[model samples]
Target: MRALTVKGVRIDDTFAEAFGMRATAVIITADSPRWAHQAALTMTGFATSVIGCGCEAGIDSELTAAQTPDRRPGVRVLLFAVSTAELQKQLQARVAQCVLTSPGSACYAGLDGEERLRLGNALRYFGDGWQISKRFGGKHYWRIPVMDGEFVCEATTGLTKEAVGGGNLLIMGRTAQTTLAAAEAAAAAIAKVPNVIMPFPGGIVRSGSKVGSKYKGVPASTNHAFCPTLRGAADTALDPDAACVLEIVIDGLTSQAVAAAMGAGIAALVKLGPRRGAVRISAGNYGGKLGPHQYHLRDLTP
Candidate 1:
């Protein structure tokens, strides 16, 4: 196979395998942008992977006062789960614990679809029979009294079963610093794309994992093949000069959105080139057995 180079970075002829997921999006508003972001960060915290976290979530975008339903500063968060039942459970728990607890916070549907997930509907119980149900703009909302004032949340949010998860990029560099820089650039680029979220901390994952572990009962373990320190001792996938590898995993409402985000990230890496960024770019997959969606690196290269 011919080598595929974009700018000075070598693009591996591989694809990112992604599985289908049940996803939902919610808009959280607060008295200020700081509070809104605080709630979002808290809600999305510890939610990096479904294998352990029960869900994968991240802030999709920040919203201005003019963009929110309540005319306040807010953020849009997207969450993905393996099944609708799990998604519903996670969504209700996060919103009830994080958003409702945030001062002056309000939650609304950020997405619209025939299928729906419980939001305020489940949290209304906390109101202790004091929660007020209101119908506004053909949508149902529950106003739950709190210390600051009241937490207003929509009865339900849209759920999309067509969501895609596990889209990723492997950035390998000669040093950890350069590899981190490349991963940051890719993360920033991907953040700008709508309908997608990078659930990892800072949108970069240092501990990339394979399907299973050497120990029994562990569903996943460190990807030793990509570890620079384990080069000769393991079935290494990196070159001799490669010292570090970082991955960016993405989940999107649609396959197109995931592809768009991956393309944007690749373009950002290409702009930085090999000298300041990644020496090589690849993707993780389980030989196409993991999922139905396969985003080819060559096809995504800009």
Candidate 2:
């Protein structure tokens, strides 16, 4: 396929294929911002991919005291899963293990919808018959005893079925250094957009994968087509000059949020241009068979 040039950068005539997912959000508040962020970081750990981790989660944004239900500093966390059952399980487990154990931490609903997932309702059993239930300001909450003091959590949190996952951008460049810089810039820009999470280490992935592997029972394998070292031995998709590649995968509460994130990331790459940023910008897809949502590169390009 021919590549379209924008400010000396090549934009592939491709699209990112994404699929439907179930998502939920929760707020973890504490006496101070430090502990709140610590709990959020711990809860989101080892949750970069649904294939391995059963969920994809990240700290969506930080919240001020005025923005939280308990009037304390907090962090809003978002989790995505392939199904509602998996999302509900992850939410309960993470909150029980991470947030409840944190000092002075409190959990609350961060979203509102008809579908609800049990939060404190599932965890009140941990209190060993000492849990206290109360209704205040038209919301139900549970107070469970703990060493620090008590863990306050909402009865339930709203769930949204409109989440989109696997929206990606592939950055190919002449060197790893330039490619990494461009990826970082795109991540920073995407972080400013609300309701989306990158869900990868440092918001960048070096080991992008294809749908299947040659070995039996292996669900996925490395994307050898874009590997710089396999240029001669394999069917390559890279330009002759591209020496390194990086990918950014996104999950959002809504389809519009994902598209906005993609547009922001592409604009950041365009601002750096080809010399300092990516030589080519493409996307991963399975010939429109992977998912229903297709984010075209041309439409996202600035």
Q: Name the candidate that leads on lDDT.
A: 1
CA lDDT, candidate 1, residue 47: 97
C-alpha lDDT of candidate 1 relative to the true structure: 0.95
Identify the candidate with maximal TM-score.
1
What TM-score would each prediction reach against the true structure? 0.99, 0.98
- Where does model 1 exceed 4 Å of error? none
**How displaced is residue 44 in candidate 2, in Å?**
0.8
- The per-residue C-alpha lDDT of model 1 at residue 143 equals 92
Mind giving the per-residue lDDT tens digits that candidate 1 earns over 1-302? 35598777999999999999999999999999999999999999999999889999999999999999999999999999999999999998899889899888999998999999989899999999999999967999999999988999999999999999999999999899999999999999999999999999999999999878879999889999999999999899998878999999999999999999999999999999898999999999999986999999999997
- Model 2, 1-302: lDDT tens digits are 67889898899999999999999999999999999999999999999999999999998899999999889999999999999999999999999999999999999998899999999999999999999999978899999999988999999999999999989999998899999999999999998889999999978999999978999999999999999999999999988999999999999999999999999999999898888889899999999976989999999988
Candidate 2, residue 292: Cα displacement in angstroms equals 0.9
Error in Å for residue 119 of model 1: 0.9
